[model samples]
Target: MTTDDPATDRTDREDFPDWLRQLERDIRPGPAVRLRIWCRRRSRRLMGAVGVLLVLALVAGAAAYGSGHLRRPGPAAHPAAGPAATASPTAAPGPFAGTPAAGWPAGAAGIVLPAAHRTGDFSTAQVSAGLAQVRAALLTARLDRAFMAGRSPDPLLRHFAPAARASVRKEYATETIATYATRLAPDARLAPDPPRVSGRITYQATRDNDGARKLAVTTNFVWVYGFRDPGARSGYSVVLLHDTVVWHLPYPDDVAAASRGLWLHRTSSYGWGLDCGTIHQGLVRPGGLDPAAAPFPEDPEALYDPDHPIAVPTHC
Candidate 1:
């Protein structure tokens, strides 16, 4: 069906080229790791093209692309006031009021663990201990004020084994710090309200190619930040980061004590509502506030749903 609206037709022609370019540049192809990522992107793009209105919707609402399915709260209806009636109480809206994150727990409280159970070689008690350490490291990396402000990530690095810590430190200098922790760009400022978070932690007993016993703790979490302007009452610009990290705990009997602590095994991440230019600088810059750098459009479920498959080629 062709639209009588010339404006809509013009928009489709203008936006498709840039959107396709941004998507291609952001996804790097690799033989072993990026094949799946490339396919997923292809499929999604095809579907969007087939549904013309969907592509238009995505382009029109680009600023909110990764901010989760934009769920603006409906206006509240008030009962007619009378001397015979009493006022009802209602909780005020929160920082995430219009996003999917509105109902998620605030900050670290959202990073919850399940009841520990035996797995492979690890007993219930061992699993609990390993998960606790992983949780602490996550809090330090993502929510620590200094770390997020681009300060040294030593606090997070220290949680890894000595050798792993050294490796991570090197990666940080090369601007790979965002893979290990969420850091704000030099120009960005978070709102007074703490970030909203939601996700899960799971663990399993596993072995490496060397056949050494280890406990693997995996965390998949999404953090949503609302940026504050100098004197604004509230921030409309939001940054959403989804990170998947696997922490490895070497068996005490399999290695020296120095190597027995938690080590970073693997990690991947993707973000929405960010200035992509700053992503290469290893910092998150909320984009909605900048007219020239509006956030890139992405599938809301792909970012907000923890059970969704982790995005690959995690460059931006």
Candidate 2:
């Protein structure tokens, strides 16, 4: 049962215990058993690969959805119920919404005065006072409801120097009042809301041809009026008036009391959306509202822009 020689000491099948030998023989796999084992390993690896592919597909789908490349089906649209269900394709915008005056301040508020500062030889206080007087004049000429309604123009003329007031009044009576103030036509009625105003006022000290020192104040403004037009496209018609008024303030002691106040120096104005046929009457009549009104050429963009030089009014 034992050997002492080194070569003979090697283990043999006989050295295995009975139980171990029996177990080895009983557990030996045949062809079918080997095949089953191979199939199980292959199936596990295939399942793992399939799971990886499924995860990849889910990630790709999520990315596509985030990028807006994937669109999901939505519920079908239902038909509208009423005969007027369809909306107007080219309907006009709401009152003033489509025009440049949409954001402008209403009434006299839009005549913005520049901060008073010493310019040339004028003092800060004098500049401030001059600006105030100019503001009052603008409000009376453009925004005064009574004046626009065809009242006496004395209120506006009162602001002018006594010597200049007579000439201005003479012009007011003989020439079209349209140049000096907005006067509505006998048949025209403005909307209850105040007219919209926009523009700026500036002042500087300058000399006349005779070298007399004077503070020159200039105002550039656009006044937009909405007249009641129930039959018009937007339920109202628009009239745009642009005016530039210049006033000269002489030193207190330079002249007599009667000529001491602000003097109307020069003025230029242009208006759009007025009936050319009746405008010569010195009253405002909205053009588009009347079928018989004559149509004149105008650049609407230029009308709304304050910096654009006034275009000569076209007469039909």
Residue clash pairs of candidate 2:
none
The estimated TM-scores of all candidates read 0.64, 0.65
What's the lDDT for residue 44 in model 1?
Answer: 79
* Candidate 2 weakest lDDT stretch, 10 residues: 8-17
- Model 2, span 1-316: residue lDDT tens: 4457666434433444566468767785455764565566579788999999999999999998876743665577798776776765986554566678878899978978899998877789989988888888888878887876765779889887787788767666433457657777788888866788888888889888877778999988889888888878778878888888888987665667787777878877888788765667667878843455455455465688888686564543
Off by over 4 Å in 2: 1-95, 174-176, 289-298, 313-316
Model 1: per-residue lDDT, tens digit, 22-42?
775787334444445455647
Query: What is the TM-score (0 to 1) of candidate 2?
Result: 0.65
